[model samples]
Target: MRDLDETDVEILSLLATDARRPFSEIGERVGLSGPAVSDRVTRLEETGVIEGFTVDVDRTKLRGGVPVMVDVDLAVDAGADSDSEPLEAARERLRDANPVEHVFITAEGDLRFYARVEGRTVREWLSGTFEGVPVDDWTVTLVDEVEWTPSIDGVEFALTCAECSNTVDSEGETARIDGEVYHFCCSSCLSRFRDRYQRLEEGA
Candidate 1:
């Protein structure tokens, strides 16, 4: 993989602010030619640093309801009943629930969802959504406004080894095998991964 530098970081920050910002404008700000900025962006995309650009739509204007953030704690005996849906299955169902703009899973395994809901029917919506989900308790908060600002300030970027999930650093290695790129923290892990992959392929 290509090593990221200060210029790359600045490019990312600029793009994060406005994905449609022209390359010439970005070049003027970053002291590079437009083609140089485009090349760097293409490389960033190839290295997976830049996922696809997205559009930010104001759902509140379209949905015409009060926006709310709901956090749900899973019950200890969640999905214990034989006839009840499994915990993951129930979570998947909630994720696919209508009108939910965003869903997040906290480190502690709690579920949080953002949606626009009718103020009076908030309770009804909660009960209906969590009826099949194994929820212990939940809290709903009214969101007055939403602001999204992505920055690379004070951030260190590193890729994880495809085999052992370790951070790849300057001393690490990257290989292209089977027409795809993979990173490794050490050569031994890379060899092991390749051998296991070969064995699996032969067995198949």
Candidate 2:
């Protein structure tokens, strides 16, 4: 994929703030015609860059409930490694757990599964769902608050030039690793970065 231009980055920034913003409104802000903006938006959607529009439903407002975060540590099969299929199976098991809203596999220590549970009392839901499960360990963190930002920490953004420190446009074709975002000036820089990282890993 080719790198994104300034206009594309602007469009992404606008969308990142409000996914449901209309093409006409976005076009007005970005100095593009409505149809032109729509075409770009359609292309982004088709290419999977814009996954889907979603609403952040306030679960707490429903029946006066509170949201809870559950950390589930799975006891993998004796032969199973971190990325083993059995780990996947264990994650699939949580699909039926009514309290689970989202699950993530963390690269952190032994803590494998992170589940977001929405219920009146997070502790009660976790106790009921985890009953009889052979969990290695678990931790619960109450989500005190959350804030959405245009850019994330640790995700590498492409540099404008190898010599310049300016951020490269990140409308599309940018790869995100861990939390760091990287933007390549060209294929050569991308190759160079990968080669250096590979050597570092080998040495380690």
lDDT for residue 196 in candidate 1, whole number 0-100: 93
Residue-level lDDT tens digits of model 1 in 46-126? 766676774232223222357789887666663455523434755666555544656777776667877767777988988
Candidate 1 regions exceeding 4 Å error are 1-63, 78-87, 150-204
Q: Positional deviation of 29 in candidate 2, in angstroms? A: 29
Model 2 is weakest, by summed lDDT over 10 consecutive residues, at 170-179
- Residue range 38-91, candidate 2, lDDT tens digits: 898777666555666742323243222344455666666575455445455556
- In candidate 2, position 17 carries an lDDT of 51
How high is each candidate's TM-score? 0.39, 0.34
Off by over 4 Å in 2: 1-61, 76-86, 108-121, 148-204
lDDT of each model, Cα atoms only? 0.67, 0.54
lDDT score, residue 118, model 2?
51
Clash totals, every prediction: 0, 11
